[model samples]
Every structure is written in C-alpha cells, then in structure tokens.
Target: MSWPHVIPYANPIYFLWLAVALLPMIFMLLIKGKRWGWYQSLITLIFLYISFGGKYWQQGLALIGYVIFQTLLVWCYHHYRQQKNASGIFYLAVALAILPLTLVKVIPFVDGGAAAIFGFLGISYLTFKSVQMIMEMRDGTIKEYHPLRYIQFLLFFPTISSGPIDRYRRFEKDLLEPPTREVYAGLLNRGIWSIFLGFFYKFILGYYFGQVWLPLLNKSLMHQGFFSWSLILYMYCYSMYLFFDFAGYSLFAVGVSNLMGYDTPKNFNKPFISDNIKEFWNRWHMTLSFWFRDFIYMRLMFTLIKKKVFKSRIVASNVGYFALFMIMGVWHGLTWYYLLYGFYHASLICLTDAWLRFKKKHKKQLPSNKFTKALAIFLTFQAVCFSFLIFSGVLDQLFFHH
Candidate 1:
C-alpha cells in the first residue's frame, strides 16, 4: 500500500496542522523537566503510528542505526577526552566520522540508498551537526548531554534535511533549562518572523531561481565558453541565491526549534558587508567557520607551537593558515577538488599575512592612491570567486577529468 493510502491523513497540509497542534504540548513538555523521556516516548509512538505507511520497518531500522552510531561516536569521544585532554582531538574525530558518513552517503551498499546521496535520511544535517558538537567538545564548552535532548537535537524534523548546524553547548543548556515568559514571548515572535521570511525566500525566490535560472544553467552546461563567464557571473548571483536558500532554510529551522523552546545557534551575519575574505568567512556561515577556528585552527596552531614549528612567528603563522583551511576543505567533502580548494585558500592567507608583514617592514614607503584600495577590493573578490570556481566542482567536470 502507498503511504497516503495507508496513513489516511498523511497529506501535506495535515503535516502543517499536526505541527501547529503539537506546538503547545511540545513547548509545555520541554519546559517541564530536565529529561523529556515521557514526551519522547509519546512522539516515537506517533512516528510508529505513521510508519512511512508499510515501510515502517525500514525507517525504524535506519533510526536504530543512527542511535547506535551516534552513541558509539559520543562514547569514543568521551574516552578520548579522558585520555588526551587536548580538545582538538574532537575536530579530528569529527572529520573521521565524516569519512564514514560520506561513504555511507555516496556508497549505496552501506546504507541502502545507493542512488541518492542523502539516503541515510539526515546525513547532510548530521555531518554539520557532528562538526558543531566536536567543536564545542574541543573548546571545553560543552558540559553535558541528555540522550533525549540529543536525539531530538538530531531528529528535529524541520532541520533534519538541511541545517543551521546548532552547537551543543548553545542548544543543550537552553533546552534543558527553561526560559522566562518574556524570553519565550520574544523567541516566539522572532521565530515566527524568521520563518515567515524563510518561507518567502524559499517559496518565492528559490522557486523562481529553480524555474528560470537553473534551466538556463543546465542548458549552458555543454557549451560553456561564453556561458562559463555567464555562469561565473551567475554564481555571484547564485552565491546570493545560495545564501537565501540556505539562510532561509536556517531561519525555518530556528523558528520551529524556538516554538519548541529550544534556542538554536545563529548561522549568518550579513555576509556581503564583510570587508575581507577573513571577515567574509566570519560573517558567512558564522557557526561553521567558528567551529573550524575554535576546534581545528586554534588547536592545530597551538599544537604546532608546542611541537616547536612556531619558534619563528612567520613560519608558525603560515603553517597555521594552511593547516586550518586544509581541514576546512576536507570538511566540505571527501574529494580531491575540495583539498585543492583548501590549498588555494591557504595560499591566499599566506599572501595576506606576508603583505601585512611587508607593510609593517616598509610602512613609511607606502603608496597613497585611491587606485590601491580599489585594486585590493578587485583582487580579494577575484580570489574568492576563483576559489568558488574550484569548489563548485564544475571545473573538475569540464577540464582535467575529460
């Protein structure tokens, strides 16, 4: 039997009604206790009742797999922490987890969805969430985990497909701890407003982009001489497109989580206004970059210094830049192109640092032309776009592989 035929009331609009109806109970249950065991049990039953229609067995088994893997990963990290105490081991562990999950995403035999990369349900979301968790663990910022909360953290329906990638420390405490009525009211309004914006972005703008621009890009894919320039120009537009699409997705996540009384992490911060590539990263996907900085970069930088590569400040800075971005690239995917993208960025960082060093060495002899400022902007943007060109995976498709 089909899902709709079997589940009777499983239509799309029914989901919105179910969500609106359940919101108050979820909020009350969340505010009631340290552990929402009762609430969770009830919800699991509801999921069982729906059962993906007759495919319930497969969905249940898939969930069981997630619990087993996620639990073991957390346990292993706990064991690692007891031994090393360095904390950066967390990002390394996260990267390791990504390898297996990436395999599971790409290699269909492992998790049954061989054709679709996102087959393991929330693989994309969990990958980013794993990064967030490991980052907090490394920073010594995460104090505890309630299994129920953690389960809900991963399975929160709104963000299960895509994400804002909330940090454990930021979410766990707020979730376990209750907020004041004023805080709840404010959060409610903010959540509603953000979700409203997200819907407009997704339904209105994203739909338009998919209908108009996406078809054009697909058609231009084969004969991309002029189209490549057009595609590159389109990417600047598509960058804006991606921003709204994903940011809209994030807002949708935050709003839904807020209604449940959980405070999610902020993911974006007016990225376009950023003056430099460094600042651009900070403002864009703010949560993910900070995860890299706190867990990956700081630990690697200090670890190198601890190992004596940092004896000279210049060598240490360059090494730090390269190592961090390398991990950044790897985090994006388990691909050679991602690795190259990492190196490309690392080289740019080295140039940026060296420029600062040279300027300090010859501060009195500097040029004072308006042209210099304009040139810097042009170069920095070009650098960002070129890096995008590499990671876009389009270049790999077109050039060397063929």
Candidate 2:
C-alpha cells in the first residue's frame, strides 16, 4: 500500500489500481453468484489507506477518530431509542453527531483562520449520514442497528471524499440482496459507461474550464475594472467549471458503486436546462438537495405545521426554505459570500413559489408554449450563473479585500 499520495478518483493511476483490486470481487459476483465481503472489505481498507495515507496521514488519523465518534454516538442513540423517543434526547443526539463538522466549519474563522484539528475531508457528508440515521431511528424507520453495515455505509470508499449520499436502507438492501446476474449485467454496462463519461467530464472539460479558462479569465479581468463585461464571462465560466468538476466526480462514484453491485444514486441531471430555481435544485446536486429537503426542509415544515407556528402553509414553507438553505450555506463555511449565496437562493426559491402560484391562478392569462418555456430556461440560467458568481467569491476578492 505504498504509492505517492493519491486523491480518490483524481488520477488515472488511482482508478487503474482500483479496477485491478476490485477484479476478485467482480469475478466472484459475476461468475460464482457470490459477493466476497471479506475481499471487498480488504480492498476498502487498501483504497482508504492510499487516499488518506502518505502526506495526509494527519487527515487519515482525523478520519479514524471521526468515524469512531460517530459509530459510538449512533450506537448509543439507537440503544436509547429502543426504550423511549424523547425529543430532547433526539435533538442532543443529532447535535452531537454534527458537532465535529460544526467545529470544522466554524473553527477556521475564529482560530486565526486555521483548519480545525479534528477536521477531515468529507466530514460534512459523513455527518449527514450519521444525523439522518439518528433521526430515522427516532422515527422507528430503522428497526435494528448493525454496526459493521453502518461503518461500511459511512466509509464506502468510492464516495468517501464526496458523495451521492446513499441512504442507510437503500444501501442496506443492495448489501443484503446481491443483484442477480441479469441485473448485474446492466449495472456493469452502466458502470463502465459512467466511468468513461466521468473521464470526459472531469479530466477534459473540467480541466479546460477550471484549470485553463478560469485562470485566463481572471488574469484578463484583473486588468479590466470589476464591472467589466469580462466579469460576466467569468461567471458563466466558473459555473460550467463547477458543474463539470463536481458532476464528473459524482459520476465516478456512482460508476464504481455500480461496478461493485451497489445502486448508488446519481447526483446531477442536466441541471442548467431547469425551468426555474426549484427545478434547478431537482436537477443539480440532486443528492445533497434531496437530503436537505427530506431531512431539514420537510422536517422543519412538519414541525411548524404541527405546532401551528404560521397561519399559512405557504409562509411556513417559505420560512422552512430559508432555514434549510441558510443551514446549508453555513455548512459550506462562514464567509460573507457563502452566507449571501444561501440567502440569495432562499429568496429566489420563495419568489419562484409566489410566481408559480400566480401563474396557476391566471392559467388562461399566462401563455404556455415552447417559446415561453425556452424563455424561462434562459432567464433561470442567468440567475443561476449569477448565484454561482457569488459562490465563486470573486466579488469578495475584487471589492471587499481589494
């Protein structure tokens, strides 16, 4: 397990080794109609070491500690949940689950901009898995807890660094029931296709946009004033780069999962063609948005409605949207741009909701046709790109820090 430090899915060498190592498991699944759980676990450790070893040994250690903390926390919560479902206990468990990630997000701001000692890559995503488990346990969605399965779910190597964020039950089913040979044939084909597509997206197009054009744009914009047309170009360029880079990583994760016989979810779905802000979320980063929608927005709305917090469901839902996105923004970081990015999206969603209601009320008055749909898409694209610009933090560099 001695190779130069490798980021997961970042280089061809990593994937080459991954494919070779996974050969045994793949063979067992395809030829013998069996899953070699022991072999799979061995390779999981090997890949984790390569990704977290060498210069990143500190992060490796941090990841180990984080996993242990989460495993124990979830186990204890599950134990208590069997006897009683207390709101205070559940809230405390959820908070504890997210505490490490919270420190990771907040510490840098207050600690002379130093990264938290306990911080590791994918802490936020791991925390999401942990907290979701606790919530579901409280709701009795998960009747029993299995520690090994939970750890495997959290540390599924393909998605360890970033995620399509598989749910416990969804993932557990794939583990409990190995895909039939016929079903696995489809998975294998799709898996290979996804990996090749990911290469095109991440290595080629992502490189051109993020590594090539973005720097060139920045250099040109530095010469021009902040309000120049080049800034708009930068916005669109950054947006494209962000999409390709992330979507490409996601494809690789899903592809690898499929190869291993797990039906990992897809993250992106041609997001730029969305009809509105809400639809954009449905397409883009589908897992994270869907996770937040299910675990945060829906829960908040339910709580509000249950307690009669607002007279109108619309107002309550709108408020829940703000809470959800604001939490999401903070999870990204405490920077002004990140905060504003969250606020901006929340505002757009609320406005979009209002317009939708208006459109429904005046269905005959408003035209619905291909031309109108195209117009909606075009406008939505511009708005989304602008939000990405804020997300890019160039404005903060140009205006505030300059």
Candidate 3:
C-alpha cells in the first residue's frame, strides 16, 4: 500500500471531450435553420461534458436518461406556451419539472447512493435557471420559447460547469442577437484576463498554500479548539485560500461567458475593499448575494417589514442582515457548515452596521482618506476570510476546546 498522487490538469481528455460535445453549438451558430433544437442539444451536451468530466461516463445511461427527460420538459413548456397564455401554468410546469431534481438531490440525504445520485455538481444551478426561465415566460418577460433556445439556455456548457448564474432574459437576448465583433473581442480579452487571474490565484497560489497548510490546519483544529482564538489565525489562512479559490472560479465563469457572447453577472468586485457588510456582499460572490437579495431579500423586505413587527431600524437592520447572510450561507451548500457560515457573516454585517451608526454620532472624528479606504479593504478582506473559515468547516477543528 502506497500513497497515491493524482495530478490536476487542463487535461487533454477534458478538452477533447468538450470539443466534441460543443460541435453542435458551433453548427447552430453557422447554420441558419432550426437554431433552437441544435442549440438545446448542444447546451445539454455541454452540460454533460463539463460536469461529468472523464468520470461523467460512469452514469452514462442515467445521465442520458436525465437529459431526455429535460428535453421533453422543453417541448412541454413550448407547447404549453402555444396553447395557453397563463404565467402561472408555466410556473407550475417549471415547479413540476423541478420535482425530479429535488427528489434526486434530496433522496440521497437519507439513502445510500449519495455520490452516485445525490449532491450532483451542477444540479443546483440548472434547477435555478429552469425555474427562472418558466417564470419569465409566464410573466411576459420572455415573448417566445423555442424548445432549442430553452435547452441552450439551461445547458450552455460554459455556465453548466459552475455559474455566475445569468438569468434567462440575458441568455435569450444573446441567442437572438449575439454581441458584435468588437464585443466578442472584448469578451474574449476579458475571459482570457479573468481565466489567467483566476488560475494564478486558484491554481498556482492556492495549490502551494493548500499543499503546505491544509493538513497542518486540520491537525491544529483537532489538537486545539474549534471556537477558540486559535481558529482566528487559521481562519485567516482559510479565508485567503477560499478567496483565491472561489474568486478564481467566478473569474473563469465571467470570462468564459463573455467569450461565448453572453454577459453573465459580475461575480466579484474587490469585495474585501467594502466599507460595510452590505457593501462587502456587493463586492463578493456578487452574483449569489444579489440573487438572494433580488429573489429573497427585497421580496421579504417588502412583505415582512411592512407588517410592522416591532418596527425599529435596529430590529430591521438585524433581521434583514441575518436573513440575507444566513440564506447566503445556505446557498453555498445544504450543510451545517454553510449554515454557520451565514451566521458568522450576518454577525459581522450587523456589528459593522451598529458600529457605523455609533461612529456617525461622532462624525467629525471618523477617518476619511486613502488610509481609510485601504483600512476598509483590509478589514473587509479579513472579515470575509472569517466567513470563509466557517464555510470551510475548519473553524470547528481549529477552535475546538473540548
């Protein structure tokens, strides 16, 4: 028995697999007929290609089976659109379609097939987009639903792997009218820049640090404590690693989307530089934060706050901040670590807001200059790293006192 080493790569197998899979999309771009059908098939294929990788073949028949079902869903939505104009019907259809994914994702939680079935890499994203598309269709926001375009939108390879999570409207706009040459060039340039930066951080720097630190960090947590000050230090390292890690992925997603002529949302905007937690969210995983804000926060704010439950700024501030970041944690994954991740972030944001308000009472003494900006960036970065520590679950190890 020996320690086995596996090397990660921009492997040729992966590239060839992608090339073969994306052929249909290329054909769709060039040919002038039945664009939607070709595009949908291409999208689905790309999803499979990117998500499964070399091991994707293990589930071969089942994977194909899933795609086929989703295709029928595409047709069903198209036909439903043709027959009726009710937005609720489309929403219902999407809701119905999601049951399969929900079942697949949730069942393994109690069953034995967790890896084979549950915890699918891309299902979370695909499900979100599918629901979004149908809702948009019903709302009159999307005037038409070609089955192919629907497939293409849901399964586009670049986004399928992981996503910056574009909405259907933007994808539809791109499909009907892609960017101009200059735009494509800009996209390509951006994509390249993004990928380079992402790889350097995620791959190069991340690899070196993880190789040296993760094992030690893991050991320290068990020997030390999970909630102690020791965690505060390793949490910093975890935060750094997590930043380069996820930021790298987001960078790739943005760059890749741009090259493909679709404008996925900007996922990060130097979030560590933000002066407040709300602003930090704006700067980090910028997409998910907004997704929760747009789809969850604003709606809840409208519905919940208006009811006048103890109406106070302090109350509203705490409630809104808690709900936002907790959901943000849950969005990371359906796990306890993620749940705590949300709690940690919400705490920071709440405390930060409280401090700001307190500082406002003594406004003239507050720092305001380049130094302040730099300090804000440093503090935000550290705060975010603390969030990452929770996210990574190492906080349980590093801070353990028992």
| Per-model TM-score versus the true fold | 0.76, 0.98, 0.77
Better of 2 and 3 by TM-score: 2
lDDT leader: 2
lDDT of the candidates, in the order given: 0.65, 0.91, 0.65
Model 1 weakest 10-residue run by lDDT: 1-10
lDDT string for model 2 (202-259, tens) is 9999999999999999888877859898899999999999999999999999999999
The deviation in Å at residue 304 for candidate 3 is 2.1
- Most accurate candidate by TM-score: 2
Whole-model lDDT, candidate 2? Answer: 0.91
- The sequence of per-residue lDDT tens digits that candidate 3 reaches over residues 1-402 is 422111112333543454464445434433432235445555555446545545554444444555566667756776788788775776578767677566664565677465455334566677667666665655567776676666677666666646777787777787778665556657657766886787787777776556567667667767766565556767776667767777777776676565455677878787666877779887877766666677556756765678877578578767877888776665565677888878887888778888888888988988679988788878777767767776776645444533
Question: Against the true structure, candidate 1 has what lDDT?
Answer: 0.65
What is the C-alpha lDDT profile of model 1 across 1-402, one tens digit per residue? 323212312234534644764575556644652335466447544543353324545544555566567756765786688578664676667767566466764565455565243234456566667656655655667645456666666665545555666666666677557666667777778878887887777666876665577557745764664345666765564555576777776777777667656677767877665545776677777767776687567777788888886678679878888888887786576678899999998898788777877978998899847777667767676777677767777666566643
Lowest lDDT sum, 10 consecutive residues, model 2, at 108-117
What's the lDDT for residue 32 in model 2?
Answer: 68
Count of clashes in candidate 2: 0
Better of 1 and 2 by lDDT: 2
